[model samples]
Target: MMTPLGYSIMQALAGPVFPLDMANFFLWVTALYLGGIQAIALMVHSKWLKRTAETFLTLGTVFTFIFFYFYLNLRILSSHLYEAGELGYMGLIHALSMKNLVPAFIEFASPLQHIFFMFGALMFGLFQISDKIKQISLKTRLDSVYAVVAPPCPGEELRKAVGKGERRDVAILYADLWNFTPIAEKEGPTATMGLLNRYYALWDIVVRRNHGNIDQFVGDSVIAVFGLIGEKDACETAVACALDFLKEFPSLQADLADRRLPLVKHIGIGVHAGKVAIGELSAASGQPRVAVIGETVNTAARLDSLCREFKQELLISQTAYKPLSLEMQSHFQPMGEVLVRGKNQLQAVYGRK
Candidate 1:
């Protein structure tokens, strides 16, 4: 295709005296073909195609430079032949055939080659820098998500766990602010939100200190679990965590009182231990989080509800109470079996005696 195009271009430029020999004309055709391939390859998006494009670009550039230098040398040789009164196509061919092409090309192309090498190096450096910046930005965003969601372990481990899910014996702790609805209504939105923030912060501290993973916060309630990451004494740790919340309640109340905000008088916490299914759940915001669900979790929430009925700050079911140390067990007395809502059998609940 390029052969005929080159022939026509040469005829148009030189009229009846076309100067390029067959070899020179073929070089021009090869350079134009490579340049065309380079242009086409640049428009593709595939990985392999991009790599091919780069290879073609370098080859095309080299070919173009070779053609340019050779053409220039041929022109100079032909002009010399014309000046010496031996102006003929045969003279031009004979001059080109005898000339030492490699040395001439090297002499003319060395300086320009160094300049091109430096430019290529600069472009490659910039590309590497840009790629690094993009990777860092992506990592930052992922770290932010991990920090906020706070899975048992960040990165690949958490992703694998969330993917497959697990069934484990865990101690579930359910805590709800006593009388929060009236407080929210009386305080209004801004004050209510501020109070909730402080309240949740207090729970967060107490829960984390006892090695508990907060599963979710639903309205005025918080659900946390121990042994989600395979802790040995999940039940004991949960009971201790609930006790800490009771101990911290007054400080939180005092803080609210100092701030002139409507204070929640008490918080009800319930602890229960059993095998539950741990899995990922999507929030309304479309972010996935780890959570637990089963009869054990429900029993814990029911025990928390029993706090209002029993007029106690903490309630622990029999399963949770059984794992406490002797000294820890001494803190609570059995409340007897009672008909808990949504359960067929009576559940034995205990509270601090």
Candidate 2:
């Protein structure tokens, strides 16, 4: 549209005798080529292809601008050559083909064009490579963070509740590794950390399989919550997870022994169900960490601590026990009321026999 409009205007001013020169033709072609390349660069979704197209466009613009500048200036400074028409587009092309014989063609195609083009190309390539590296690094960091944090809850509403503070009844499961301290001390930091990671990895599988979310790992303990997203039988699910943990422990220990790492003899798990405040707590790193806090969490931790004294691998409070199916309930026997520290009333605890 602009091409026809410009031609019409030029004809109106020059009485239909407007000269069609090689420079005008070249300018029109260059503009269309650059415009087409820019459109393709914008349309492509692939990062690599988009960058390649953009680099090509940049190089084309730089080289075209340099060539046109020299071409037009040469025409103006040497009118005799233009009048003879030896410096027309085709003539210049012929000169370039025989550039070794024609020194003036060398001036038209200077070393400065190559220098600028190569510098632009190099910087564009470096910037693209740097962006790609940064993207990969960020992805790795986020993967590690997600592995350590709780798995995302299913629904958007539930996720929002967890992010903001909300009172929800959830079955809290606290599992602590038995005899880990001595093993850590004997095995040293690096080996002990590896072993601990293995144990936590196993725990993560069991908890997720039972539809529970692991909130955090504090030292040798893992705190997980079931039904935070409103599962009806959260208590039964928590008890089932504890049982699965016990069932999987022997295999884990055997694997550790095979690897020649320090072995953990047992794991103590406690499950309690009640209302708890679910919210995000700001860490020292200024990131928000999802936290479940209340008396129920404290009770569950205490019950886990009592596992050694009670000679049981799994323990559950009365609140957790009441909601279980009869078959699941039969797996435990009441250990009677015991006054746990930091509680006014004697809490009824049940131990898995």
Candidate 3:
């Protein structure tokens, strides 16, 4: 944006301007600026686009002299000394015939200045492209972490809040695939892992479809979060995803059997909704990981563990239950208050047998 006008002003100061040269200069300047802006637009899209821009610009810069070399050769071939009969009449005729093969070059007042300008442009493009690519890479990595573990948010918004803790109200789902250890020990390690792979694949589809984040997977357990992490609230979708997993459990088992994975159909889920502080937490290695930390998150996982004692497949705490839509409220049955092992008070747990 700053180049053409500056050059034009300097040129005007250095010499008398002719009407024809001024017109040509203006046209070329316009074309240069327009093309530059458009290229920048394409380069901003992704790392792929940025690399493509850098490659094209660098190649053009690197080969700038090669283009001039070809032009010089073409001019020599077209205007040979053969025309003066130094070689022969035939050579002169051949050199004259080669005139059509000569390519025109864009004339510059000073070749050194032209090269300097091109070098400067190349560096400008590279610096811009490199900086943009870094931003994109960092954003994509952060987004993947949030989508997988923490709540989903816009990349720009997330960047503005990085490392800074902020409270969010969300619904957390903790699901454990039960009886897998028995199957693994009975059927051997290979079949057990195969089952887990297929089982997790099944659950991933449902969770993503429900816009729920699969926060962490430990061994055979899956932790999912619903609520503001997605379009719907935790109370609305968290319980639904749990129920869907149970509803689809038998069918998945049958599919696993067909694949010779093993017969195992045990999944326990706990749903709770409350406030959590979301941010990046660094480990001893100084490696940072995005985390959702709060009592609500712990309570949800605890409820999932409670399923082992109650012999129930799905459970929801009052935090998630009370906010349930009327139609949803009808789907769950009250299990009364239960003394959770780590809790100070009896938790009012609800279950769907």
Candidate 4:
């Protein structure tokens, strides 16, 4: 049984072949439908068609001509009714009655032609929906990962507000993975990245446990600050986190050796208490990054770098060292004041035994 739509196509096709010929009318309608399909095909496959539009346009014209030819033949058959003696009359009338069957057949096939175009439109619509969903999913995943792995940096207006100058003390910790560059060069990029991830994870745990937020990561170094916008006991917190990081390092080192990778068994930490201009800086790439600048951060970094010279894994400046709790002071060894380079005044530095 034919559907109503299919039957309508048949009735439209089987109309008068001469006077009032709907077939010829249908040809022009079919051509218009084909035009729409071609336009849609160009849009759906724009990337591929951009290089080949002229060729596809030429090919599309050929297909239109082929369809027209089939329509012409249907007309001849409908007019002559398949009689052996009528072949000549069929060709003769087809050429002469162009105003009849040609137009009627085109009009009849118009709906079928448009129906074919709808398939192309449907496919293009599905592709658009799929691409939209994929983009949203990718963005969502990226946002979630960022929330877990990266610290948030304040926006421009917020940084500007912070930069207006407020006097406040901050406990700062500078942590450097032991011998990172040489291990990275020896292990290759993949293994090196894996090692860094494990190392950072340990830092994350220690810092978070001690109620400190990671301020920033610079290569293999992490800067964590306590006491500032939202913290108390900043000095004690920074020292506790550094000590905890050291205790976890040896076990982590053993695990790496088991995996046939170089162990980062030791790391250097430098802690200092001082005033800092903590705010955000816009990078060259137009992304904002949290930064601590001023003498406090400089002094801390200088002390961290000095660990290699002192043959020790951790150090605390006098400002932070003196304020430590009795329990915290018990674990540290006093290394007398040293004149750090690029500084006019002598700054106190200590080592962990």
Candidate 5:
């Protein structure tokens, strides 16, 4: 196809020259035009055009055969008319050879080709637009979900909490969903997340409303701290939160049934109190955070992990209980001394009635 255009361009560039024979002229023209179309296809990144080009090129070979048959008929009829000089008969033959037949073939084939190209272009454009919309919508939903589920960075909040005293003593609580890893293996990843989310939804409301900061969520466990807001009954608040979490878990489990999920949820909560460095850990975007250190944090983990052995859901240490007002201590029932792992001395433990 490019032959026609290339030869014309070459002729123009080199000045006028004698034209080639019919065969050479048509061959070059066909080659130049085909090449130009392919170049255009490459320039545009449209799936429709690419597919159409493949189809058109494949079917283009048939058009050549069609043209050959028509050309032969025209030659034969032209010879007959030239031998007889019957102008009217020649006119009729001319219409069959070139006027009606050739134009009709061109008209029919041109529309089909255009339709193929157009359909391809439209399909490609639609697919691209659809993909972009899906991606944008997914990103937007994820951002919104994160805003609700994840706690805000508390860089400023920690400073304010720290400024309350030379050493800010806060009660840290850790709660782990019992058998979460084993449950995930049994139920699959989708059901496990759904179960975890339902459980978080219940605790999020309880902890936030009780003047507690949801410190962090490690997999299926929740770490919350109290006394950040004020020096209120820190132990009492921590105990209440633990008891409330225990109470609320059952209803949350029932809700999972509606989603075709099993309801096997148990959490072990360990509460301890000590001084901690509080601030944002991430440098990228200024997000506020708090870091709890010392034996208070360690004891909390120790007590929480021991829940399985003791067959209890909530455990409060002596430090966490020491700050409790008389009324708060009255609500807690004493469980005898128990030895914790990595500790030589036995640690006292308490349970809520």
Candidate 6:
């Protein structure tokens, strides 16, 4: 693409050996460098883009460098034809057929080519290093946030989570500590946060041990998911997880007492089976967070709220309850159909204390 400009450039440089055309080559180099710079400048702030921007810039730099090399070579080829009294399209064909072109490549690949190669490599390194740092930072943040035990996922599974409407039938588990507002108001922010963290840390162990993912953490509440992975029945896994949590309740309270903090207890849990889409999330300019979306998540949260009203420590939707093992079902009481928040129709839910 730069051939015509290179041809004009070659003409002026022939007399002075190093002249106006050399200066023009520098300008061409600047243009290629700036193209990469502008693209990175625009996309560097996004997490998704930051992950890919270096690759994109690297490709652009490589292609540009390739085109420039061919353009300069063709420019030199054009000059040979002019000297031989061959001109225009036919002249180009004749010049290309000639065997004398090999020596010209080494002649042109001097200080300018070396400089361009170094600068382009330098720019690529900068983009790649920046991208890697962001990746490490985001992974660290996710480690703290997701802090749940889940089966190892192939690289593609996480990629799927970033896509829109990537839905599947997964079990949702929503749990929240009882009377969080009162506790926070009584103990102040620091103590409340400490308590919340401790509670979640314990629950994190339960969910991870049960093969579930903590889809998200809302203030005083955690929304976990089962069947996003593993071959186990979603409902079965969810019930087992909840049962484990409830059975561990007394032990958790005892541990708190040992720490000499307020002896507190009780968290409500609601389980529902349905579809969930791992909603793709955007990064804040400084902070990045992922979001979970779909009606199933909402239904699970609503079920958790109703647990307090039903005076039960665990409440599960009819859909989830149906899939429970016969032995497990025997322990649950039928709470009947009740209106759930954000739904136009009443939903049948069961309870266990």
Question: Evaluated with lDDT, which candidate comes out highest?
Answer: 2
**Superposition error at 101 for model 3 (Å):** 84
Error of 1 at 291 (Å): 1.9
Q: What TM-score does each of the candidates earn?
A: 0.54, 0.55, 0.51, 0.52, 0.53, 0.52
Evaluation by lDDT, superior candidate among 2 and 6: 2
Candidate 5, 63: how far from true, in Å? 74
Better of 2 and 4 by TM-score: 2
Judge candidate 3 at residue 87 and give its lDDT.
Answer: 64
Model 3, position 177, has a per-residue lDDT of 76
Worst 10 residues of 6 by lDDT: 146-155
lDDT score for residue 25 of model 3: 47
1-353 per-residue lDDT for model 6 (tens digits): 27536754675565543333332544465566656666775656655564565455555566556546755666776877777767775445444432424444455556587568756766776676675655545543433454333322223564465455466788889998888788778878776666666567767888878987776666778887787643469888888899998886775565455445455667789998887676545556533233457888888888888888888889999889988889989878889788765678988899873
- Model 2 stretches with alpha carbons more than 4 Å out: 1-157, 282-288, 341-343
Cα RMSD (angstroms) for every candidate in the order listed: 20.0, 19.2, 19.0, 18.7, 17.3, 20.6
Off by over 4 Å in 4: 1-148, 151-167, 230-232, 281-289, 341-343
Candidate 1 regions with alpha-carbon error over 4 angstroms: 1-163, 282-286, 340-344
Give the alpha carbon lDDT tens digit for every residue of 114-182 in model 1: 557545655665565455444444433322332222333323455465555778899999999888888
Specify the poorest-scoring 10-residue window by lDDT in model 4: 139-148
List the pairs of residues colliding in candidate 3: 227-234
Global lDDT scores for all candidate models: 0.73, 0.75, 0.66, 0.67, 0.65, 0.68
Q: What is the lDDT of residue 69 in candidate 4?
A: 57
Assess the local accuracy of residue 326 in candidate 6 as a C-alpha lDDT between 0 and 100.
91
Q: Can you list the residue pairs that collide in candidate 6?
A: 149-208
Worst 10 residues of 3 by lDDT: 145-154
